[model samples]
Target: MRAGGNIEITDLMRFGHLAAAVFAGWILIAPSIDCARRGLQRETPLSEWEHMDTFTTQQGCESYRATVIEAEKADSKNLYNARYAYSLCVRDDDPRIKGE
Candidate 1:
């Protein structure tokens, strides 16, 4: 990206690589849920958790997700907020989130 919204060639190349890699790897699905309404805060690609980088492998995604869960468990935060009990890892190409 540059001034006047011009996309640089380098940016296109990077996006091309990422687009290809998206089909070959895993993505961590870290969704925060509103328990009372049983509503999901990650029902779209624009969700805040989408900012997390994609993992190149399921093992990597699982390892990171587990660490997050452990941290959440250890932290005695207020329960009035959100919960990540439904957080998980899914293939990047999964139909549910891949917009297929």
Candidate 2:
């Protein structure tokens, strides 16, 4: 019998392999977990802007503008126009609204 009761060499090897697999999995997933944490942090403040119907990134605001413009060009009336206008109104208000 081993020091830990009946744990043999094979059992120790299996435990080592399991530990290594778990470590590797954590390494692979760590970056994504960090990215999600950062994304959440960035999004939390932007939620306040959401209530005012605005975007937190230039790309987002520009995309909204383009959609509205396209809708107008097609002579299609929709809510995108108002959203684009609102985005424009708040575009320069938050400098931290760069991007992710």
Candidate 3:
């Protein structure tokens, strides 16, 4: 009714249109952002997996022994670290690891 004053319905419609536009823009952009963040942009070379399988099987018995030894070491180390971290968490005031 006054100068520079729009009607209530017009204002509400404008606000809704603006909100819809923003939402549409976000919907379009979100998947692209996720894909880039998740490294989907990188194209894997076709031969890489083939080469890895060939190399793994070619080493035969030695590779199997080495893999088992490494796995055992990793398991022991993880167990030790987990226990130490849990004990430290109990002593601290942080509620992250504390549970009922």
What is the C-alpha local distance difference test score of each model?
0.64, 0.42, 0.32
The TM-scores, one per candidate, come to 0.51, 0.27, 0.19
Off-target runs (Cα >4 Å) in candidate 2 are: 1-52, 76-100
Two-way lDDT contest, 1 vs 2, winner: 1
Model 2 residue 50 CA deviation in Å: 15
Clash tally for model 3: 0
Where does the lowest 10-residue lDDT sum fall in candidate 3?
A: 25-34
- Of the candidates shown, which would achieve the greatest lDDT relative to the real structure? 1
The model with the greater TM-score, 1 or 2, is: 1
For candidate 1, report its TM-score.
Answer: 0.51
Clashing pairs in 1: none
Question: 27 in model 2: Cα distance from truth in Å?
Answer: 38
Sort all candidates by lDDT, best to worst: 1, 2, 3
lDDT of 3 at 57: 27
Per residue, candidate 1 scores C-alpha lDDT tens digits across 1-100 of 5667898898889999897876687776655555786666756452344425488888998888777667677655634123344566777667766555
Work out candidate 2's RMSD over C-alphas.
15.8
